[model samples]
Target: MLNKVYFSALLFLSLTLNAQTSPCKAAHIGKFQVDSGESGITVIERNKKTQTEINEKMGYKARYDIVWIDDCHYELRNRTVIKGKSWEGSSPTDILKAEILKVVNGKVFLRLGSNFSDEVMECEMIKIKS
Candidate 1:
């Protein structure tokens, strides 16, 4: 009886670890769109080969250099100012980080900004193309 109980405990532990280690995949490298609840939609383009990302919304576009911390997390350094919008009063070198919280059925849930901060934003990204 003791041996059977030990075996069951080990099996449960292994399954839990397996679930926690499921990382994001390379197939997420592509463009995505989310409705902004306004007249325009927000577009995000990620290029894993180039290690870059472009975000466009409300006629403004910003580019970032991506540094992958792991398969599920990455840091984004704002490398360029919004081309179609004026940035005369703001710093051009802003930074942000993002993590893949979950991926289900080709849709990725992303959390943006520092995890310690209370202002983190969550967005769902659907792959549009490779």
Candidate 2:
């Protein structure tokens, strides 16, 4: 009696947790665009196999090497300077951690974290190309 109820509760909890997990999938490999309210349009091109990302925002182009922490989260380390730009003073390497918060109807909700702060920004990206 009591044992059966306990087992059912545990099972329900497990199923709820499983359903809430957001996993990264191959469908995320593509070109996406985000229309930032103030910053203008930002485009992101991602290659899952190479773990590389190219971002264009407000006319500046940057590249990053991505390291996946899990199916839903990844860290991006800037790789843009290696392409030809000369490094000036000791500029801190820009890195950002991001998580796929949700994917619905070809759009992805992303939460991004910058190296300089604990604040997180949420943005929605639409898949432009696969």
Off by over 4 Å in 1: 1-23, 26-28, 49-57, 86-90, 114-118
lDDT of 1 by residue, 22-91 (tens): 5486434777766656636666777863233333544567676777888888876655645565346545
Q: Tell me the lDDT of model 2 at 12.
A: 100
| lDDT to native, each model | 0.68, 0.70
Q: What TM-score, computed on C-alpha atoms, does each candidate reach?
A: 0.66, 0.66
Indicate the residue-level lDDT of 52 in model 2: 36
Per-residue lDDT tens digits for candidate 2, residues 18-95, read 887454563357888888767677677888633333334334555677778888888877556423343354243766
lDDT of 1: 0.68
Candidate 1 TM-score, C-alpha based: 0.66
Q: Residue 42 CA error for candidate 2 (Å)?
A: 1.0
